[model samples]
Each structure stands twice: as C-alpha cells, then as structure tokens.
Target: MCGIVTAISTDNVVPVLLEGLRKLEYRGYDSAGLAVLHEDSLVRVRSAGRVAELATMAASRHLTGNIGIAHTRWATHGEPSERNAHPHVSAGLAVVHNGIIENYEAIRERLTAKGFVFESETDTETIAHLVRDKLNAGQPLLEAVRLTANELEGAYAIGVISEADPFTAVVARKGSPLLLGVGERGIYAASDTSALLQVTRKVVYLEDGDVAELKLTGYRIFRPDGSPVERTVTVSSLSADAVELGQYRHYMQKEIFEQPQALGNTLEMIAGGNTISPQVFGAHAGDVLGATRRVLIIACGTSFHAGLVARYWLESIAGIPCAVEIASEYRYRVSVADPETLVVVISQSGETADTLAALKHAKQLGMDKTLAICNVPESAIVRETALRFITRAGPEIGVASTKAFTTQLAALALLTLALAKINDRLTADDENTYLTALRHLPVAVTKVLELEPEIEQWAQRFASKQHALFLGRGRHWPIAMEGALKLKEISYIHAESYAAGELKHGPLALVDRDMPVIAVAPADELLEKLKSNLQEVRARGGELYVFADAGSEIPESDGVHILHMPEHYGMLSPVLHVIPLQLLSYHAALVKGTDVDKPRNLAKSVTVE
Candidate 1:
C-alpha cells in the first residue's frame, strides 16, 4: 500500500504536503514524490528512497504551489525507482495512487491504442494518462476524475490535480482508505487521519466509491453515481503527541511498555460497572448479540492470534460455538454462515486488506449482524459494521504490534463477559469479579513489565540460537503461537509453536541442543502435562526456557532456566504471560542487529493482499 496526501491552500503547499506525507510514512516509505502547481506549471519531483530524499529534492528545487498532491510508495506494481515513484504526470495532470488496478493491462493497451505512450511500469501511470485524455477531450476536472474512477477496476485511493483546474484537487476511494481533513486554512485529503493531525483535527472518512473535491475554500463529496452526498465531519480524538517517541529506543519498545495505559483506556467504559452491558458495543449491540447463534471471527496476523484467544473465551465462558479463521484464507473458501451468526472482525490498523474482504464476504452471505474490534475509530471496518469497540491503543508505529494486541484481548474479554451475561451463564457476582480483574489489569501489567531486565538477559541467550520451539496447552497455545510469530517477525529466527501434548507426536526429534524450547507454564491444571513435555525436550538435549508463574513449582536447574512471573492471573494469565514474550523478541532482535520497528518485507498496515 502507498500513502497519498493532497492540499489546496492559499499559500505555498509544498511544506504542508511534505509534513502530511511524513506523518503518513508509516503507511509506506519505499519511495516518495509530489507534484505542485508552481507558476501555473506542474513541477513534479520523484525520489527513489524515503520521504527525506523527496523533501530534500523539493527544497533544492524551490518547489512552491498553492495546489499539490504527495505520495509515499510501497512499490506494489513495480520496483522502487524514480520512474516508478508516484505523482505520475501527463498532459498537465498529476496523480498519486494507492492499491492495485486489476484491469491495468487492459487499460494500458487501450490507452496505447489511443496514441499515448507509456513512461513507467506502474499502474498509477495509466490513471494519469487516462485523466489527461479526459481533460483533453473537454471534460471538467471533477468529471474527468469521476469518469476515470469508474473506468479503473479494483481498489484504489487516488489524488488527482491538473493545471486546467489548479484550484481543485480531486480524491476518490474504492476498497481503500481515504479521508478529508477540514482545516481553517483549506481542505486536505490523505490516506489516514494521522496525516492531517498536524494541520486539522476535523476529518471525514470516505466510504467505498466516494469521490471528494478539495478546494481552497472547502470540500465537496459525491457518490459513485455522481450524485451529491453529505458526509459527517468528525473531530479526531487522536493526539499528535502520542505519535512521538519521548524516551524509548524504538517505537516497538515504546509500544510494548504502553500496554497498561492502552488496555486501561480500552476498558474504561465498562470496567467500573457492576454488571456487564451490551450497550457498550454500539446502539444495536444488544439486539444483534442477543440473536447471535454462533460466533465467527476473521482477522490476520497478530489480530488473528487475538481472535484465536477469543475463540476459547467465547466457547468456554459464553457457552457459544466460536470459530476463528485467518482473514486471507477465509475469503477464498465457501462459508456456510447462518443468518444469526455474529461475524466479529479484529484489526489494529482496521485497513487490513484480507480482513476487510472477509467482512464483506460475510455480509454478502447474508450475515448482517457484525462487530468490529478496531483501534482506529474512523477506519473502514468501523464504518462498515453495525457495531464496534475502538481499542484506544493510540497510534501503534511499530510494524510488530504490542499494545494493540493486548488491548484487543481486553476488549474481547469484555465481549465474552457481556455475551455470558446475556445467556445467563455468568452471575452478577461473576461480572463484578471479572470487572475487578480488569480494573486491576493496569497494576498487574506494570508488575509484568518489571521482568523486562531479566527477559533481556534471556534474549541475549536467545540471540545465538538458530531454531526455537514454543509450547503451551489449551488457551495458552495461541499465546505460544503469538510468541513464536513475534520472534520470527523481528529477530528472523526459525520458530514454531506446538501444543504441549502434540510434542510427542513428531516435534521431539527436532529438539536437539541447537534448538531451544520455550514453554508457557501458567499455574493452571495443565501444568503437570506441560512439565512432562518440557522433560521430553530436556532429555532430547534441548535447552528448556520456561516462563512460569509463581506457584507453578517449576525450579530452575542446570539445563532448564525459568523466569518467574510475579503472580498468576488465573483466567487473565494469557494477558500477563505475553509481556515477557514481547520483551524477549524485542531485545533478541536488538541483539541480532535486526530492524526492530520496520522489519524487512513488512509494513504496519497490509492494505493489499
């Protein structure tokens, strides 16, 4: 996915465009470019690297314009090069685009037959050429953009500017994120609200097939059929200060330590209650969740792991049948969804490509009862669903998620309690008890964070290991899987997680001295079984690394090293157990000299498949 920003102001727009693009750098940072109308002529600058390079080039060229559009690319259709970068210009028209054009080849061939020559290997160039042709044929600027939007297929969030109508900047979106920021100076269009936070707090998020026109005075939006539509402009509650790194080594470390406050904020609405309330979800939450026959959770990456953990909670506590599916895998398969199914979607960025597709797929199957557990309140998932819970985990900059994951778990636990109350499976006393646990969570998490120094030493030991195995049973199995995923994501370690009982089947043979085994041993009923599994690994010449809760009675020995958790959190053990795993992976990646925040081949949001 690429980030696009467009600004039409009274003064020079290059500086504002650059600042907005910098804020959106988290969406993409491979290549950067911008086209500004200077002296009634379009001046386009393209750089083959980060936004800094593009900013430097624009500064050196003295780029100045009252109307401009900017982009930071992730190189989807072509390699990252100056020519392939965005702001593809043709015939006085400039365009910045995100998402893939499914019919790009066909469009290119048609444009080529019209005697228009191509310049770069990007699908975005086709839009520029097509818009140029439209404006050449005497079409208005907004009309040309509307016609072009219908011509191209697949998802796209595009910003288009032309010398013919230099006062207007047009932006449109279909199956991708785009928002309009209403500021005192002018109107701004960007891929995320974060981009406009520095200039404007009021924003209007575009729905699928909505086209907007940004002018110096104001902005106007329309539906796919060219009919004028009204959009609600809401003030963003996101603080720009949260995106700053006050005193952390990296965004990953900062976000990891922010879990307590993030989770507390997420749970604040329902934590002080003596009884669980369905109204916490949304206006129709009670009716929708009350009629739910089964639960289906769709998500990707760390969000998917959170869904897996929710599956156990829903089925065990709420007495409902729950199934978790990887959003990417779920979209391709046939689903026999019931009309009474509650399709819950989880995402941190809320712009995750496959998860959005899967949500649409479920809706297409006539499952109208849906809920989105998301971090961003203005995200597409929140607007698409009838119910939502924004996990106020505040701007997770790290590609490897930390606070976002734990906050989702806390929200899911709330969902579990609310659903249990509806089914009468949970007593009023039980609700108060769970609420108390949630209220105490911030303190509990602070205690867990105290083990970071010890975990860092364990990470130092883990830095040299090439292969690793993680083991947990029942509800903790997903925690083990998440731990392994974090290690592989940042540290580049080859790791896998297996249920403790599954170890004897086949994984025992791979447990040599070269491979270390990490176990999640909570003070639960399954501790004895997990301990026996650890013994199997130890006998096979594998070093055992155990994160055991206090009262688990797991003593450290010569080959088996144990990190004692200060307390056992009963049903909330998974939440506390995951902190050490995060610290371990972060410090391990630090020791291995790997990218801690922006790991290779990974972006913060997966806006494309």
Candidate 2:
C-alpha cells in the first residue's frame, strides 16, 4: 500500500505534488520519491523515511518540471531503501505505483530475455521498462499504458510520465483507489481525496479498467479498449480543516484524544438531543424496518470489529437477526438476497476494496435496501448506496483507528435503537435507558482518558513481553478481539484474544509464567466466570492484568495487576474498557520504538485487495 500523486499543469508542478504528498503521507510513509519530466529527461529524487526528508532533498536541488508524479511507499515487494523507493524510472518513462503487481516476475523474465535491465528491486520498475519497450516499438504513450495494463495481473493504480510525451501523464487503476482533481489551473491525480483537498473540492473517482490521459490543457477518460467515456465529477464535502493536525504532537495522539468530541457529535446527530437530526438513517427507519427480513454487516480490519459489536446490539436489543461477515470472505460466498435483506457496510474511508465489492455484489443480487456507515461523505461507498450514515469523527489520520471506531459503535448503537422503535421490539422505558446511557458516554470516555497515567505504568511492566492473551465473554468478546488487534497492529507483539470459556479447549497450552494476560472483567454477571478464568491463568503461572470496575473485589496475587475503572452501565462498559487497552498498546509501541502512526506492512486505508 503506497500513495501516488501526479500533477499536470501549465506552470511548474513540483510544489503541488509535494503538498499533495504531505496530505497523503498517512497512506504510506516508509520512503518517499518523485519523478519529474524536465526538458527531454526524467529527473528523480528519493529518500528513505518520512516525507520531510524527501522535501529537504528536493529543495536542496532545483527540481523544476511542468509535469511530475510522486510516491510515498510502504514496503511490500522489497526492503525500504532508496533503491526500492518509487518514481521507478527506465529509459524513457518514469512511473509511480500504488498496489501490488502479482505477475512481475513473469513480465520481468520476458523483458530480461529482450535485453532490458532493471535498476531497482520493485515490482513497479517492471512497468516503466515495459512502457519504454512499447514506446520504442512505435506505440503511442497512451497505447503503451493500455498494453501494460493488459499484461499486468494484480491490484494497481499507476501514473506514468514519458520523455516522448512530456506534456501528458497517463493513469490507470484495477483494484486500488485513484482520483482525478479538476482545478481551474490544471489537472491533478492522486490515490485518495485527502491529497487533492487543498487544490480543489471537485473530483472524479476512476473505476476499475478505466484510464485517464491528463495534459496541460485538458484530460480525457477512456476505457481499457480506448473508448471515450463521460465521467461524472462530484464535489467533495471534506473540509480543508479536516486534514490538518492542529497543535498536536502526532496525528495518532490527536485522533485518540478527539474521541470525546467525535462521540458527542455522533450521538447528538443521531439522537437529535443537542444538534440537528441526522437524516441519514432516521428518515429511512420505517422503510428499513418494513422491507428488511435480515441485516448483514460487512467490513474489514477495525471496522469489522465494530460490526461484531453491532451484531450483538442489533440481535439482542433490536430483535433483528443479523449476520456479520468479513468483506473479502463474504464476496466469494454463495449468497441469496432480495428486497427483504438489508446490507450494511461499515468503513472509515468507505473505499475499502473488499467491502465496496461486496456492496456492489449485494446490489447485483437485487438487494435495494443497502446502507453505508462511513466517515467520508463523498466516498464510493456513499455514492453507490441509496442510504448513508456518516460518522462524525472529522478525520482519523492514524493508521490504527481510534476515534472512528468509537464513533461507529456510537452510531450503530443509535441505529439499533431506531430499528427497535420501528419494529416495536423495545418498550419506552428500555429505549429511554439506552439513550440516557449513550448520552453519558462522552463523560465516561473522558473518565477513561484519565486512566492513561496508570495504563502507561502497566505498559512499562510488560513492554518486554513477546506475547499476550486477551479474554472476554459474551458482548465483551468483540472487545477482546479489538484489544488484541490494536496491540498486534502497532506494537508488533503477537497477541491472541479468546472467549474466556474457550481458553481451556486449546489456548490454555500457550499459557506460561513468561506470558501476560489482559482480561476485560467489568462488574457484570459474567465477572464471576471471568474470575475463574483468571485463576486458571494464574494457576498456570501466567501474569494477570485485569481491567475491573471500581468496587469489584478482584482476588490479589503476587503476579497479578489490576486497574480499577469507573463504574458504568453494562452495555456501555465496552466503550470505556477499550480505552486503557488502546493506551497500553500505544505506550508499549512507543517503548518498543515501533512506528505508532505508520506500522510496517500496514496502510491507513485498504483500497486494494
């Protein structure tokens, strides 16, 4: 997962490309590079590490060009080094690529037999050599891009600039994201809308098998067969302020602290308590309740975990039968759908590849009652679905999502309440209690944030541990899974989560004195069973770290540690319990010297399959 940005203009384009890359750095930041078509040669500058290093190198040398393309890479095919940094150039063409090329070895063999030599270890470099070979054979630049796309066999969003066509840039996509920005001065293209937010709000999202030839004067959209197509440009509603990390040490920290306000805004919109009512779902509640026979929640990564939590809410509180599936797995399964089945897709960016494909598949199966819970209002998920629920988390730049995950939970909780009301499953008192608890969540979350100092101290004790086990029961099982995910994602620690009762079946063997276990043991009926599970871990010599509610008497042990939490209602406890685990992971990663914002082999958005 890499970020790509290209600018074609009448004036020098280096500055615009750099600014765009800054906004898109969250996508990938292992290494950075840029290729500019200057006069009759391709000028390239690259460096390892953050975009700031690349900016310094570019400024030291006057890299002036009217057309240029840039990339910030996350290492996939090779190690993070200057040799593997993108803006991979060949004889006459320079290209920046986003997704993986699965057939690169096959193509490389064919090209090597033709006496073509590769200078870099990236799969993207193969495209540049292939385009150069096509151009040498008298094919036009646009035709060369099309032929390359035909030969390629995986996910990719590529931008190519050639000395033969110094005035134009070609772009094509298969499974990854690509967007075209229409500005008054020139045309800009990038992997996501965040890169183009500063220059223009109007954008056209490129579809699979579509290509665009961008020139200084104008741009044309074409199919893979070179047929002209009329593309609809939608105005982006994302504010310029959304991309900035105002007065914060890092975007990750800012996003973690923004949860209170984000949750409050989402609740206010959904419940119509302090702000304008959200028309996203309330307007369609009656129709959704009347027409739907079952509900399906599709997502991946952190969003999938949120869906897991929502499954409980929808089934238990709303009396609705619900199915939660990972999007990639759900897309290939045999499915039957009708007007009676409602598909709900959860995504932060709303551009996740598998989830988007599943949404399209459901629509193809003739399911018209489809809805999206997303943060980006103008994303493909929102544009394709008939109904949309927008999360109020403004912009989550962290690779490991914090605010967005909580807001999704808050939004889904409200959705469950609405469904229960329309379906006559919930009585007036039940609805009032749930709503009141939700309204108090912002304050509860604030109380959780205050536990950071204690969490940091706990993290110091287990920062050197190589593995951890997380346990929860019932509704808290999803919380356990999410806690393990956050720990592994950022800290690079091997962590596993299990239903507390299932530990004895298999996972108990992994327990030892060296292993540390974190259990989400809130004061509920399940607390007694969870205590027995903790004792089992202790009997096996595994260190125990329990997050318990205040006034709960957890048995003391020499190796066990406890962090008492502020008491809250049962359903809302997960919302508070998740906070300390997040901080624990954050501090552990900080101590381990791992990149908390951009973890290895991970991207903020999974636009490619």
Residue-level lDDT of model 2, residues 1-609, one tens digit each, is 578999988778888889888888787568999989777688999998788888889888888888999998888788899999988888868999988899999999999999999888889989999988999899999999988898899889999999889888999988787889998888999988888886788899887888899987888989988899988899987788877888976677788888899888877753545222225474765676567767899999889988888888888877888999999998899976767877889999887888998898889888878889998876778878878888889878889988889999987887787777767787877777887888888888888889989999988888899999999987788889999999998999999999999989999999998889999988887888988998899999999999888856896669989898977457777777888888888989988989888888788888777
Please write out the lDDT profile of model 1 over residues 139-239, one tens digit for every residue: 99998999999998988999999988878999999988899999888889998888888888999988889998888878889987899999998989888
What are the TM-scores, per candidate, against the unseen true structure? 0.97, 0.90
> What are the Cα lDDT values of the candidates?
0.90, 0.86
Top-scoring candidate (TM-score): 1
lDDT of 1: 0.90
**What C-alpha lDDT, on a 0 to 100 scale, does residue 413 get in candidate 2?**
83
Model 2 pairs in collision: none
C-alpha lDDT (0 to 100) for residue 188 of candidate 1: 91
